[model samples]
Target chain A: MLAFVITTVLCFITYLLLTTGSGTLGLWSLEEILVGAILSLIVGSLARTIFVKDNFRMLNPVRWIIFIAYVIGPFFVAMAKANVDVAYRVITGKINPGIVKISPDLKTDFGITMLANSITLTPGTLSVDVDEDKNDLYVHWINVKKKALEKKPVNYRYVCGKFPNWIRRIAE
Target chain B: MIFNLIIYILLAIGVFFNLLAGVGLLRFPDVYTRLHAGTKCTTFGSIFICGSVILIGLRMWYTGSTDGSVLAIHTIFALVAILLTNPTGAHAIARAAHRSGVAPVRAVVDDLQNNTLKKEEEK
Candidate 1:
């Protein structure tokens, strides 16, 4: 029931965000509100299990703040650098492409997922696969650094600088 | 006037990055590298484009237009959606390509394949 309510509320918020300025009731109309409520409830009930899962640690507001900080800070900077790196490669056609594996030591599926998504967006590395048993990630690196492979399983820092720590603080 | 200049600059950056994404897609040699181009560039480009829209909306709201509030909020949501889905989609494509026996062209190393081989041998 808690999960149901949580999912419903989240869905409703999303609906409201989408339907903003549709009515005079402070950016939402009575009809819009009513429709949104009903739709979100239905969608929420159906999606509660999948959406909420067993771990609700993400519901903590502090984690949300950290996530926002991460997006604005290191994440944004890395994305800019990633673009420039890609642009350089695109123009000069220089690449040392390879697939390397790294164990971020993240325990939860959510953390791994977040890390993978962040890795994809932030650098020349794209997450290619996962080792579910050990929670290992296979990363497609545009530039394979020799220092990164000086040790086995590689290092998360070399692939995604300081991201694992940030994700750990937020997700774990 | 200053806002217009900022918006123009943001739009130019956004368009330039998006165009880079397209060029990278064509210029890269393999599925993984192309995805590295297609996904990251577009995601970064969209951020700038949406940032410009959000700025416009904020300016309008500052000028006392209620509709601008909705516009800015909605644009933020769109940006969040792109941020969430784009990378996941890229991951899916990369995973599928790897699993379907497509090798990374000119790859100096392939640990994922070695892992798979080890798993197969273990079984």
Candidate 2:
């Protein structure tokens, strides 16, 4: 609870700083800041309690820094590459047009969300759905792989794109 | 001068990503893939665009323009609304597509269909 309060305070302070400069808050702005702060505290506490009910392992600063770096680095890199590939395909009309399944060996829901977000952010791929039981992602790829690819209309891969590994580093 | 430069850069980044999103939507195959390109890219691109507007608002506020301040603040709220709603809407569309049986082009194993089957069997 103490940590939650600290986080809430920090979040409110950051919000204030980003939204309005320091030490010059007018009465109206002060009221806004106070309201925002109260809301932040309530939301922060609720979010912490609900999301971190069982484990608060993700709150570590080191893990967060590493995660941010991973997301901004390799994940962005993959997105860039995909963007180029997509552009080329669009210009040349070389897209294979297929859907493939990717089972990125992820344990947590956060990991899955990261992977899905990464894929969705990329230019040519769409994360269709997830199999909640086995935790597999149904992805629709612009260009399905040749060898591993079958025409069965339902393919899943353990390692299809560079997305899974990058997301693994970032979120898992 | 420096502030204007930052705003221009932000606008450029935002416009580039927005164009990418549009291009992806046009070029990508299938409904789901097009939706992916159309939604996420625009969301990211719009962030930078709205961010530039926010900076412009701050600059105007400093220069004592009430209209500029209002414009900037309203734009920020609009951006927030977009950010909150876009992805959730996209997810809903994708799920609808899957339920409607829009299978991946060359998919080998469909865990979603299998899951449905399993649920039916359990029932």
Candidate 3:
């Protein structure tokens, strides 16, 4: 029931966001609202099982606020630096590439997924595969660091700086 | 005038990074590196481009054009979609490439290869 409601609301929001400026009826026409509600209901019912993933923690308003802050704050700075790093590597043509595994110790699939995606977009790393049972990520690091690999599993910091910690706050 | 100036600067930086992505794509050695170029650079570049559009919309809204809010909001939604989907798609591609035995060129190490071999043996 919760899943259904969440999905319905999310779908309706997406529909509304897409169809803005359509009419003067409070930024939507009566027809648009009716069509959106009916469409969202259909989508909501179909995706209810998959949409929520048996997790209600993500629906927390506090997590959403943290997520926005992370995006606007550290995440944006890291991305800008990543672009400059990539630009430097492109110009220098000096790369020591390798795939190394790291255990992030995240309990949930969402956390692992978020970490992997963050690694992929950040400096010097691309997520290539996962060890699902162990919750380990196999990252292709553009510049392999000797210090990180001294451990059994490479440290996440050498690949992504403080991202898993932030994701733990937001997702875990 | 100031808003247009800001928009122009954003557009310039966005275009430069996008073109640099193209250059990196052509120069990179292998699949994963190519993805680094194709995905990250484009995402960064698109942020600036979409941001400029959002700024334009904001300026218009402040100047009493009601349509501006819709324009800005919709562009933001599009930007969010790109941010969410681009890296996921690249991850899929990287996984597929590794699974198909397309090895990273001149790699110093490959932990995924061991996992694949172990999985294959189990199968």
**Top candidate, metric TM-score:** 3
Give the DockQ (2 decimals) of all models. 0.82, 0.31, 0.79
CA lDDT, candidate 3, residue B68: 93
Task: State TM-scores per candidate.
Answer: 0.94, 0.70, 0.96
Task: Name the top DockQ candidate.
Answer: 1
Residue B9 lDDT, candidate 3, scale 0-100: 99
User: Candidate 1 at A172: error in angstroms?
Assistant: 1.1
DockQ of 3: 0.79
For candidate 3, what is the TM-score?
0.96
Rank candidates by TM-score, best first.
Answer: 3, 1, 2
Q: Which candidate is the best by lDDT?
A: 1
For DockQ, candidate 1 versus 2, the one ahead is 1
Q: List the residue pairs that clash in candidate 2.
A: A99-B105, A101-A155, A154-B107, A154-B108, A154-B109, A155-B107, A155-B108, A155-B109
Candidate 1: tens digits of C-alpha lDDT, residues A14-99: 89888887878988899999999999999998999999889789889999999999999999999999999999999999999999
Which of the two, 1 or 3, has more lDDT?
1
lDDT of 2 by residue, A1-172 (tens): 7557656876776565445532346413676687878988887786766545455566678778877686567665755666566556656656555545566778788878766766666656667777777677766566655676543434333233555665565555
Backbone clash pairs for candidate 3 read none
Q: A-chain TM-score per prediction?
A: 0.95, 0.75, 0.97
lDDT (C-alpha) at residue A112 in model 3:
90
